[model samples]
Every structure is written in structure tokens, then in C-alpha cells.
Target: MCWEAGLSTEAGNSVDPRSNGLFGVYVHWPFCAAKCPYCDFNSHVHRGPFDEAGFVAAYAAELVHFAQKVPGRTVQSIFFGGGTPSLMDPRSVGAILEAIGRHWTIDARVEITLEANPTSVEADRFRGYRAAGVNRVSLGVQSLREGPLAELGRRHTVDEAVAAVRLAQSIFPRTSFDLIYARPRQTLDDWQDELTEALWMAQGHLSLYQLTIEMGTRYYDLFRAGKLQMPGEDLSADFYELTQELTQNAGLPAYEISNHARPGQESRHNLIYWRYGEYVGVGPGAHGRLLINNQRHATAAEKLPFDWQRKVLARGHGMVTDDVLTWEEEGDEMLVMGLRLREGIDPRRFQRISGRAISERQIAELKAIGFLETLPNGFLRVTDKGWPVLDAVVADLAA
Candidate 1:
């Protein structure tokens, strides 16, 4: 199909589609040295040695399996995310990249990112990762304060986190770090001070997240038992406002709800997800969206590390759930994901995919309530007031 930049002929038609559509790969590493109390992600801590070479082989096989299904699609980005991707040996990383190169055509400017924790031991391997085709690194520096770091069950100290950032900046072409704010006993002034320091240390991007006590996490138990207190709604709103103001002034604006980056420096891998582009996720507990036979399919792999590996070894892939989404499902997902970005969703594109347009009355009502705005580019985005209640806003529009 002949096409212009940033406009797809149909949903899920192109491989490596840039602005209009994109194809990427997400590799999940589900093992960690220790699991954090608040983390609900599929990660495991093993006391004894495990088979690294065997795992790498399984990954290569899985790649070949997905490649057969998604043939001829050029890869635009490759992300190594996990329980700490930095824990993998550089040689393992190199082998995985080699397998990917063999399976599909990779863009010359493809953004390859590896998620790392900021321990000195991990930082020492930064050079090796850069050499093994990781051009970008996102460090999990949850806090810059010792007390909070400990409370978050992070192993690294503040100094180690800073050093790791500096080291990553020196080794990788791009670097981004995460910080969790709105913790118990956290004052606005406290966050301001921490964010100021973080901005000073930041090179290209920052991900600032509010602490949410999710179900099944340790924090959930604490909150239910009256042992933990979070910031009230009003104070949380203040914190959000402060964050936006600080980041905007610092030249790193909120590109997404929890992510801030300089113009032209946004995470391309994540943009694929938010834009509802096609991607294949490999490894335990990984979820993916891909178009097969002109239908969008949602896929998820087994959550247990060993079981996933065994399944992949026996069969070609470890996918446990593969469901074709309905049109309504597509519309709801497009709104839920795209509205998180500052660029917002294209209404015409949504109409094309969903076979329906957003209600003008609802749009006008949302704008009147100060919860939504019409962008100059003709895209509709949630306003500052809307972001805090993003779920409700998206639900109303989806309804």
C-alpha cells in the first residue's frame, strides 16, 4: 500500500511503522536478585545458580517462533525489560541481539533499551551492555533518599544510584531513570527538592510515578491494616501540579502521565504501545499485541520462569493467551492508552478502527468541565484536571 508518513492504510498493516504505525519487540527477563515488596510483576529470586546458556537458547528459539508468524516485519525497537535485565551476562545479550538480527530486518536507527538497577555491580557491566547493542538504558532508581529507598526495598544507596546514572550516561547514548513520589510522609517540599536533584542528574528522560498500593502487594496489606497512609487526594493533586510545573520549566515536559522527556527524545518502544502499534513480547509474563490475518490479537506468556522456558522448549512459543479483540475492545483500548500521551489520539484514526466516531456532545461536555482540550493538531487530549481521574474520563468517552 502506498502511504504517507504517520498514516497507516489500516490498523496493524505495517511492520516497523514509525509515526503512523510501528512494530517492535519486548523481551522480558523475569528473574531478580530480590523482589521488592510493592512489586507485583512476574519476577523470581533464586538462591542457587540457574542455566543462563539454556535460557538464552530458549529466547533464540522463541524469537524464531514469533518471526515465522510476523514475517517480513522490520523491527523499529527492541526493549530488554525485566526483573533487572542488567543481571544477564553481556554475552547472553549479544546472542539475543544476534538472533533478532537473523530473524528480521532491523532499522539502522532502532532504539534498543535495557532496564537496569543502579547497584555498583550492575553499573560495572554498563560498558559490556553498550558493546552488546544496548544504545539506551533505563535505571530503576526508585528514590534518591536512603529512608525511602530502604522503605521501597531497594538494595542500592542514593550515592550508588547517582553514580550509576553518571556511568550509564557516559556509556550509553541515551539514559533515563525512574523515581516514585507521593510516598507516606512525603511533603510537597520534599518532592520538590528530590525532583530538582533528579532533573539536575537527568540527561534525556525521566519517569516519575506516584505510589499506588495495588492489590496482592505488601503495601495493600499495610494500607488495609491501617499501618500505611498515603497522600490524600488534594495533596496528591498538588504534587502532580508541582511535578508538571517543575518538569516543564526544566525543558523536560510530561510526554506521558508518568514519563517526561525532551522533544525528540521520547522512548520509541513505549510510544509503540501507547499508539496501539504491533509488537511481539517474548519471555515469562510478557503481554503483546499483534495483527494476524487483519485482526488484532492480544497475547500473554506463562508467568513462571522455568515453566515458560519448558513450554517454549517443548513447543516453539510459551504463549498461553491469544485472543482476537472485538471492535469495541479496540476502541476502548485505543482511548485508554493513547489518551495518556500529550499528543493524544487521532479521532479519525479511532473512528476508522472502531467504525464509529467520538460523540461531539461528550467532547464538548468534557472540554467544558476543564478535563479535556483540543490540540492545534486536531487531536483531543486530557487536561491537567483530567489526568488525575484518567480512568473515569476514558470510561466516559468509551461509554
Candidate 2:
């Protein structure tokens, strides 16, 4: 199972101190009440007959293992993402948080976020999660319309979704919800009205994702069979424009393509990803990007629940893949992730990591083509015209 750039046990726990920065920890709980038809994330539906205790122990073991490698680093944030992290016992969540505190230095104002579904079953645990150290909750209320909800294969109703938001607002210091638009049979007008209504209820932040048919998902199967009829290109473009206008007018401009936030209210955990900072991902199917000893690496846990659990129990870690990145590969990733942020990437930072500068020739070419703009901060950012054609621009630059 080894690949190029793979690290072995003999490499030891030594890591390059130059890799240090604002590090965060991500814990994945890969179980849900039901699997949504469109979801390709490593999530599974579980009935009764599960071993929650064993899973928690395995998770703690994985955390301890990484903490050893990243000792003395301050954790700025911790995110509990999922299949549905709300399915986890609050006690387990508390224990994991305690373990993190014990293993690593944590900032006094560390942001801790937990992802929850809007279903009452999950919502009922919000207060407990808050008590257990979760300060922010991102609810998966993917749509407010009953028809759209059903179409998206969600388990919660509109009323339940609203109630969940209300409940979360009451419990957590910060709350946000997700909404997916650009579905089949949806028009720009419909999306405009829906997004408007959502903004009215949104306290400060929103995650507006366009419905994408990913490979291996049921949605993709239906789409390839010509059974899924989504909005046409023109309609989707209108929806995107409407989203920007509405959110901007609402004073919650987009910090990322799918995320909007008020001044100083962006999700810090997500910022770590967009800024290409280091993080440790623990859980089945979780992926992590780390910089150690001046080498950037990607880490992936075992995808299966039993296998991950067994690996952690045996080796005190669940990572099945830990591979370093080549210089070209790292530069390509920098371009892709950096362009996702509105702030863009600093050219100096890029040069520091990649050991080479963005070619002046390429910069002049991109600027002439109107795909990039030089910010006052000396960062190269994608222009509005470049956003819709981002894939093409990234491809060209990477090439």
C-alpha cells in the first residue's frame, strides 16, 4: 500500500519546526442516520448494534499519536465533522476534547466547531455538545423548501430545520447552516427567493453550495442515465450571480466560493484549509495536509470503520497513507486552494514554500488575459471573470 513520498516508522517522530504555524485538529465521525443520495463523503448509515465505546477509544488513540508528533504546538481550532458528529455521544466528544487539551497546547480562545444535522434527534444534543466544549455548530439544513429537501434526500423537514436553527442559536455562541441550490427544475427566481429567505434567518454566516453530481454518488448515476434534469448553464449562472448580490447586500460577503460571513466571523477551521496551514485529521476516511521538517505531506486514514479502529488499536494511529509532496505538486496545490479564497495567496509565501517564484511571464500573461489581479498586499487573486472559469485557469497555471 506504500506509494511515492511514503513515510515509514523508521522516519521517527521528528518534524521540522519550520512547518509550525496556526495548526488545528479535525475529528471525523463517519456515521449518519441515513445516507443522502447525493453525498459522496465517507459517511455511512447505521442502525442499532454499534460499538460506540470502541470507536471513541480508537479516536482518542489516534489523537494521542498525532499529538506526539506535533508537541508544543498551539491548537487554534478543533472541528468535529462527520457523517454526522452529532450522532456521537456528548461524553465522547468531551473526552476527545479533554484528550486534545492534555496532548497539545491550546489557545485560550480556541474555536471548537461541531457539525450537526437539523433533525431533532441531533438538535436535541446541541446543548450537551455546547456544554461539552463545542462553541460553534454548523447545521446541515441543506434546503428550506419541503420539495427541495425531499429531492435532496434529507431526513429533516422544513419545520425541523427551522427549529434546529433556533435551538442552535439558543445554545451555541456561533451558528451557521448549509443550503444547496441549482437543482433540477429550479429557476433563478426560485433560488433568489430561497436564498433571500435563508439570509433573513441567517445570524451571521452561511454556506451556500451548488448541487454538484459527484462520481460514485446516486445523483451521478441518475444524471448519467439522463434521469436527473438540473438547471441549464444560463440558469445556474444567474443563480450564482443572485447569490453574490444577495449575500453582499446582506453585508455577509463570500470569504470562499461556498461560504459567506460577516466581518471577522469566518469559520477559522475552514480558513486553515484555505490558507494552506497545517492540520491533523483523525478518523476513518479523514484527510490531512501537514508540513514537517520542511516537507509537505498528505495523510489519509483507513476508509473502513473496522480497519481504522483496528489499526489505531494496534499501532496507536489510524493513518494508512502519509506521503510527502513534490515541489511541483505543492505549487499546484497552492494555486488551487489559494484561488478558492477571496484574499488569494501571497506571492512571497508561495516562494518561501515552493523555493521558486510565480513566473513573471505567467503573471503578465494571466493579468493580460484578465484572469488575475495584483492586490495591494502583493497577492495574486482571481478576478470575478476568473471565478466561473477557475478550473481552466488552474489547469493552465499548473501546466
Candidate 3:
């Protein structure tokens, strides 16, 4: 059961596996000031005073748990994501980081990103986060318009978000912000104006996501009740096209489906995910994939915040599911995650990992329809034309 260096070995021997050479840590801070209507993330609002110290301790313990499983590895990236990572006290962040450092080798140039809500309150902690070793900060701006901000259940005003972004730019070495588009009654002109303003304000990275109505979210109920009028498919396609055009012109092209970034400014933490690299997810409701003894194992933690903490305190880890994936499952996941990137996936690498070759006939069919193309270096990627029907293209290829 040697996980030293996380080197890959043959199946069931447990002699460490991570030969692809990238590893990361995802820390989910499952607490938010308020949950948005369109949000389906594992976030909750705990009224009144809560035991923050208990949670921090639990996080540290969980890090230790993962560290044992993947010991002697160099962590390339660490991401602090929702409910609102910015809500954590700087000391809590430092404690978790310290725990990671104590158990594993940290990369000299590791990218540490913290996802923050662009509120005046959280913006004040930007300096503290930086001082505590956070180099990148992604603000959840959601929108640039006053109306959309309110409609999205965002507590921060447009002005506040802007100010926070400015402050973050001044404080953090790297800064990225998010904006949701194709909202109810939103027109192309409206989006053009807002995205233009965002582009003007953007320094390096922007996460422009289309509004998706997930099954359990409030927006889903509204949509089913005929109260929410989302943009039609044609309009949605226009939004995507315009997004690519504007961001490309700004030198911040879409690196992934929803994320646009200037060259070298992409979120390395996210890249680890899209590249299908090894990583451990700590905190409530976080999902992770690791190359354990050459088998890709998917892990998920308990969804409830306090319940996760209780499990961690009692058993040293809150993980509730750790399923070893079959070769076919691994292959499908690799394609599913890797194809989201503009750089695409390498068929040879996929074959090496999955014991299956990507179908040449399927590739030909997709290419004939202009949905797939082979890179000069032989990487298979989805094209701009294909991106619109990416799900269908992937399904056909996977099938």
C-alpha cells in the first residue's frame, strides 16, 4: 500500500498510481451567505453563531486522511471552492494548508485559488487570504447588471462586485470572476453590453457560464410553472457564439466550455480536473478522482456540512463513497472531462489508461459532420461547430 510519489502500479497491488504527473487538492467550503435560485451546489445558510473552529479541525483531519492515501506527492494546485471559501477565516485556510504541507511535498510553483463572493465583507479579507498563501482569487460576480444581480439571489450589488474585483486585482497575483448569461428576458444587446463591460474590467480570466436550470434548483420550479422564460435554443447558441467571439478578440479565449482566459492565466486547479489528473477533494459534497493502484477511483463526501464534520471527527475522513471505476467507466470519464477543453484529449493516452482505443469510424463520422477534428499533434478535439452539439457528438463517439 505504498502511495509514495503516487507512482502507478499494476492493479490491486496498491503500489501508488499517478504517473500522469499532475495532482491537486480541492477544498470545498460548504457555507454561503445566501443560496442563489439557479444554484444546486452543496451550500447552506446556517443562521446565528456556528462552530467554525470545529469545521476547520475537521478539514485538517480530512487532509491528513487523504495525505496518507497519496503520501509523498507534490501538490501542483489547490482550489478553495464554494459555498463561499472567502468566508473562511485566514487562519483556517492557513491551518489546512499547513496540514497539507506537513503530510506531502508541495510544489514550488503550486497554484492556490480561492473562490470568493464579491461582497464588501469578503473583499476585506482578500489581503488576509493572500497573506495566508492564496495567490489566485475568483470572485462570484454572477452578473454586471443591477437587475440580474438581484434576480440571481446575489446579495452583493453590481457596484459592490465591481469594487471587490478591483480590490482583488490590486491584492491577489491572479484574479478571475464569473458571470452568468442567457437569463430570463435577457437580449443579445443586453448581454453584449454587460460582457463588454466585463471584458473591459477583466484582467486575466473570466468564467462565463450559461444559465442552466438544474432539476432541484428554484429556477427549475419557476421554469416548469411557466414563470421563468429562458432564452430559446437559437438565442442560447447566439450567446455562446458571441461569447467566443468577444473573448477571443480580447485575447481571453475560451479554454474550457465555460471558462475563458488569457494565455497562461487559466485556472490550473480547474485544468487538473479537465485534464483528468489525480486529485483529492476535501469537504462536504465534493467529488474527486484518483489513480489508485492504476484504477480510477471516484470519491464523494457526505453532503451535509455538520454531518460531514461529525464523520471526519469520528473516523478521520468524511468520505461516504469510494467506488473503483472500471476501465470503460474511466475511459468515458476521461472523454467526458477532457473533451470540455479546447486542447482536447489524446487518443493514445486515453487508450493507455482505459485499455480501449477511441473508434476511428466514430471519429470519421464526427469529423465528416465537422464535429470533430484531429490536432496536428494527433489530439482529438471538438470543433467550434461541434461545440454547440457537444453532448450529442460525445454521445455518438462514446456509443
Candidate 4:
């Protein structure tokens, strides 16, 4: 029940944190102005007055707590993810970043990013965030159409979203926004026109996600009641194929399954994750993959905001789970995460982690079926044809 409990490093003490590879930090801000019908992220709408100053202190303490566990690692990226991190005061963000710098040797070119929802008021805070040392912003501009925007429970209008994007572009050195496709009754042509406009507004990166009805969300309830109709499987596949073709032609290729970006503009923070890099997750419902003593450990924090804050203040950290991962888990994780990237997984690293060779028989089956391709450098990647059924590919390989 004590999420902030620490793992003893008695066996891990001989391991060098730096040698463990890419390090990043993830900070979760659990408060949001409203919860969308489709979102399953650990975000809540708190009606009472939020204690920004207290939360800032708790975040700083949590950072120090993790710093002690894994010392001497240079942080290459920091991501402030939601429940709508934009809800936080700019000063709160600054305090947390300052705490990180004090704990670790921050890479000179460290990519600091914050996730924001496009609203006029949040737009006004873009400058404050940049001044707070955030160099990048990812906007939640889910749609450019008013109907879909409302259906998605977004408070911002099309014009407001555009204005926010423009404001972000002007204030930050790097910016990206998200779009959701394959919505209920979203026609191919409707998406095409919208995507075109989105590309025009995009700077160099875009997070394009297919709408999925997650269990326990309002969407799921509506879907079960037959009120929400999703795109059919075949239609969704067509949408995926069209998205790849269009984004590739536009010169912002699909760097990851759902994220498209111009070369060199990929989200470094997200890359740290897909590349199986180590990162510390702070705040409620945050999850982390870290090197404790040389073993890769999986960590997750308490999910509720007040509970996490209270635990951190009392116990110095908010980690609920800190289990060391088995080689098989690491290998499977690498395959699932890395194959999401266009560059694919490094077989040598997989072997090193899993302590076994990939089944040549499985590879041959996938290759023969035209679902996978082997790079000249020996990495195994999913072909464009393989992306639609990526889950199957990863499962077959990881099996």
C-alpha cells in the first residue's frame, strides 16, 4: 500500500547507472479541467482548490528520492504528461524542472516537453512555460472540425485550437499537436480534408492516434449501449493505410506507428521510451523503467493525486511497484516498444536482454508473409504492410 517504498540496492550497487543507457524523467500532473469521454489516462477533475505550492514541494522531494536511488546518470529528456499538464501554474513547472537540474547532470541539449490541451487560457501560458525552461509543447488539438471536437468532449473550438497552435509555434522552439482519426462515422474524405489542414498547421511533428474505445470509459459505455458506432475493422485499416501514404508524401513520415514527424524532429522524450531507455516517473499513476543496480526494474506510482502527494511527503517517493524485470520480460518489452518505431528493434540488444536468439523459424515465417523486413544493419523492422497488424507481428516474434 505504501507506493513510495524504496528498493534496496544491495545487489544493484555494483552496477553503473550511466552504463545502463538513455535516461529520461517523466512527471505526471494528474489534474485536468475536464475528463474526456474517450480518455482512460489517470486524470481527474478536482473541484476543490488545488495547493500548487504543496504539490511543487512534493514533486521536488520525489525527484530527490529517485536521485538517490540512481545517481550519476545524465538526464537526456524530461516529459510533463497529463492529465493535462497545462493545468499547472507555470511557476509549478519551473520549480519541478529546477529540482531535476539540481539532482542530475542534465544533458546540455536535453529535450524538455509539456503536454497541453488547446484552449485560449492555456494558450496564454505558452510563453510562461517556455520561460520555465520547457523548449517543446505537444498540443491536444484532437480535431479541426467542431462536430468531432464536441463529440470528443473537447472544450476548445476549431478556431481556438488553431489560435493555440499559432500561439505555441510563436512561443516555443518546437511544437506538435495531436489528432484522432477513425472516430464514429468519420468518413475517409472528411478525415482527408481535416488531415490536410492539420498538416498545414503542423510544425514538424504530429501525434495521430486512432480512436479506441477503452474499457471503463464513457465511450465504452456508449458503445455497449449501441449508441457509439466505431469505424469497421476494414474501414479503420483503410484509414491507417491512407494516413501512412499521405504523411509519407507530405515529408513527415511515420516514425512510430501513430506518431509522424520530419526527420530529426521526433519526440526525444517518447523515443527514450520506445527505444527501451530508462526513465523515472514521478507523480500519481506515473510509471518508470529504471536501472537499479544493473537490473532493469519496472516501477509504477499510486494513481490518485492526493494519495500520491501524501505518500511522497511522508515516505519521500511515490513508487507502488518496483519489481526487477526478468530477461524474458525485457526482451518482450523491447520487441513491443521498439518495433513500434520505423527503425525497429536491435536484435543484439534483445539477445543480450533475453539471453536467447530470436527464433529463425518465426522470422522466416513473418518475412515470407511480407509482414517484416530485415535492415542491412541487422535490425528487424515491420514493413508498411506489417504496421496495420503490428500487434500480431510483435506477438509472433516475442512468442
lDDT of 2 by residue, 168-192 (tens): 8888889899999998898787888
> Which scores better on lDDT, 1 or 3?
1
Off-target runs (Cα >4 Å) in candidate 1 are 1-19, 120-124
Model 1, global lDDT: 0.88
lDDT of each: 0.88, 0.83, 0.87, 0.88
Model 1 C-alpha lDDT per residue in residues 121-176, reported as the tens digit of each score: 45447778877788899999999999999999999999999989988998888999
Among residues 3 or more apart in sequence or in different chains, the pairs in candidate 4 whose N, CA or C atoms overlap within 3 Å are 3-319, 12-293
Clashes (backbone N, CA, C under 3 Å), per candidate, total 2, 1, 3, 2
Total clashing pairs in model 2: 1
Q: For candidate 4, write residues 156-244 as lDDT tens digits.
A: 99999998888889888899999999999899999999999999889899999999999989999999999998899899999998898
Candidate 3, which ten residues in sequence have the lowest lDDT sum?
1-10
What is every candidate's alpha-carbon RMSD to the true fold?
A: 4.6, 6.3, 4.5, 5.4
Write down the TM-score for model 3: 0.95
Residue 91 of model 3 has an lDDT of 77
Q: Cα RMSD (Å) between model 3 and the true structure?
A: 4.5
